[model samples]
Target: MKKITTRLATMDDIDQLADMFDAYRQFYELAPDLALSRQFIRDRMLGSESVLILAEDEEGASAGFCQLYPTFCSLAAAPIYALYDLYVRPEARKLGAGRALLLAAEAHALRNGALRLDLTTAKTNLAAQSLYTALGWQRDDIFYAYSKTLAA
Candidate 1:
């Protein structure tokens, strides 16, 4: 097993995080947009609107990252964290980085008094689903998700 460590990402990590983030978006069938990826990450980190947990090996090379958004779970009337994005580089898979990232994210949320952490994934993404299940993340069978885009 490899020794994977995770920490809250800082501005110093923006470049590496953007590179992996671009790959992650492309994996989901989105077009590659390096500029957009960089700016989005920069905005999030600069504004403190999101939590980006970065994983690395002992060598300090980037392994992967997961971005978390903090929000309130109105039904529970308490703060909660939405794990919006989680990605592990293709070559870094099976190295325990993903699990480390998840564990770190959970710790961050819990330390901040969150009620629970929530996440969603495509039904076809069985690999990710498996990881989440192995980490004790339950599927939301009790509710459906819907969204609409408003034209600006």
Candidate 2:
């Protein structure tokens, strides 16, 4: 495993981050489109709509990335974050890059006075589940997640 350094992503990282984002979407059976991926990530990062973290290898190349969105918890009366995306390159998995990115996000959330961090993964993603569980993330038994697509 190579040494992994995690840091908040900047505009300079857009190209690599976009490539990784596209690969991530493809891993979940989505079609590949570097243009769309680039634009989406750029917009989120530039607009301050999300927190982006990038994991760099020893050579300073991007090895993985994670994106988090801020949200509020009315009941808890505190800020929270939705870790919407977490992806490590195929060659980078099990190298601790993913864990490093996750820990960085946790630290960011805590620094912002967030009370919790939440995320969801496909039901078939056992590897992700295992990683999250190993990081002390427990499965929620309280409520179900429901969504409806408003656009095509």
Candidate 3:
């Protein structure tokens, strides 16, 4: 296994991040659309809508990535991060890339004075669940997460 390095992604990394992002969507059973993925990542990076972190192995191959969106916690009265996406390449599994990315995201959030960081994953993604829990991420059992689809 190679050493994993993580850093805040910038515009220069969009191409690499987009590739990883597309693969991530595929992991969720979404159709592969590199162009859409690239454009979406480009919009976020250019607009500052989220904090993106990219991970690379010792050899500098794109290993994985995690994206954190900033939002206010009304009750806590402070900002927080919604870790909306985390993905590690299949070949990079068990190499600490995911953990490194998660830690990087946490550091970014804390550095910005965030009150907490939250995320949700497919219940069937046992590997991700184990990784998250092993890294001290608490599983929420209180309120249920709800969402509504709006026409785009």
lDDT of candidates 1 onward, in order = 0.94, 0.95, 0.93
Tens-digit per-residue lDDT, 1-152, candidate 3? 69999988989898899999999999899999999999999999889999999999999899999999999999989999999999999899899999999999989998999998999999999999999899999998988989998986
Q: Which regions of candidate 3 deviate over 4 angstroms?
A: none
Ranking by lDDT: 2, 1, 3
**Model 2 RMSD, rounded to 1 decimal:** 0.8
Alpha-carbon error at 97 in model 1, in Å? 0.9
TM-score versus the correct structure, for each prediction:
0.96, 0.97, 0.97
lDDT of 1 by residue, 34-111 (tens): 999999999999999999999998889899999999999888899999999999988789999889999999999999
Name the better of 1 and 2 by lDDT. Answer: 2
The better-scoring model by TM-score among 1 and 3 is 3
lDDT string, candidate 2, 1-152, tens digits: 58999999999999999999999999989999999999999999889999999999999988899999999999999899999999999889889998999999999999999999999999999999998999999999798999999999
* lDDT top scorer: 2
Clash count, candidate 2: 0
Q: Candidate 1: lDDT of 139?
A: 94
What residue runs in model 2 are displaced by over 4 Å at the alpha carbon?
Answer: none
Candidate 1: worst-modelled 10 consecutive residues by lDDT: 1-10
